[model samples]
Target: MKLQIDRIINEEKIEIDEVIDFSNVSMPVKIVEPVKIHLNFENLGKREVRVSGEILATLRLTCVVCLEEFDEKLKIEVDETYIPETFIENRKEERPIEELSEFTYKGSYLDTFEIVRDNILEFIPPYPKCPKCASKTEEI
Candidate 1:
């Protein structure tokens, strides 16, 4: 996941049309494809930038019933908005991101590795199950 941040990108928008490999990366959750991101940026009047976007990706999950691994396409439409730590304390009228109509948020711009870690963790499903395969537990 090599994301190129905008040099003058106080505000920027990007569309990702690529596939990401997850097996090689050690993630807390299982993902099977590259997530397509429709992103928006805001300068927030600081050295830090804010990013909001939608994430679209498929995941390989073990059936909750059978405990067998399978592929499940996940279309996670995210609307997360992240800003610096200072902003969060001052911000008001904040609802939990998961409870909101969309997945939105606030965070500081971490270095490349930290950014990737946060993104992957944020979207990774805690318990993944194949909709069609959940009940077919017996070995085939």
Candidate 2:
């Protein structure tokens, strides 16, 4: 998912298309979704730039009762930006998940993988349900 942005950074628009890894994520993130994040960077500035477009992926959810994997698709439209000020400064520097906040280009360039990955995660469902399936422990 390493996106080379050298060409896109210098231009008015750059298109990023690729699949990202979710295997290392927590339970739900690992269980559901085939992550593919797409980005189109534009609305450029000397020190700031915008990243926009869609995130598309397929999610397979297992029913609680039947325990069968069900198929679902996800597509999320994105509109976000990055500034040089907020980008990662050092690879060795450890950062909190929150400190990882703020969209910015690293090494004077945008890292497509990081930007797209963050945006896609924002669209992840907090609680996913299987339409035709029921929860094992029914709620009163």
Candidate 3:
């Protein structure tokens, strides 16, 4: 879950390859398998890091209409900017509230698993429906 970025401080880009087990962490939705995440962390400047990656997993979803359990392939795009605490502390008042996509980190290490899990979970449908249920509802 911990991603070390010390090596990439000098390099322009660093590739992070990890297979994360999210069973231990409390997730918003049920997951059926481990997530495969591949990411690239690029140093934007002195204290900013750009994280771009792809996540793939299988999620266990319950159909809201039919009440059936089904597996769904979850794919998510990871794109975010991380700013150091030092920078945020100095310019917190200057930055606009609407620019909330930036994440703040205290140190060199980042919580890769947690960040990716949160982004992926946001894509889940609030009221999921199975194929049969969806088709039936369409005819009504």
Model 2 regions lying over 4 Å from their true place: 1-6, 20-28, 31-34, 62-69, 86-102, 133-140
Report the Cα lDDT for residue 54, model 2.
82
Candidate topping TM-score: 3
Candidate 1 collision pairs: 20-34, 80-104, 81-105, 82-106, 82-107, 83-107
What is the model-wide C-alpha lDDT for candidate 1?
0.51
Q: TM-score for each prediction? A: 0.54, 0.61, 0.85
Ranking by lDDT: 3, 2, 1
- Over 55-115, each residue of candidate 2 has an lDDT whose tens digit, in order, gives 7766666655566667667777877666665345534677667544346656645666566
Model 3 clashes, total count:
0
Candidate ranking under TM-score, highest first, comes to 3, 2, 1
Measured with C-alpha atoms, the lDDT of residue 68 in candidate 3 is: 98
Q: What is the lDDT of candidate 2?
A: 0.62
Best by lDDT: 3
Q: After superposition, how far is residue 98 of candidate 1 from its true place, in Å?
A: 12
Local distance difference test scores for all models: 0.51, 0.62, 0.81
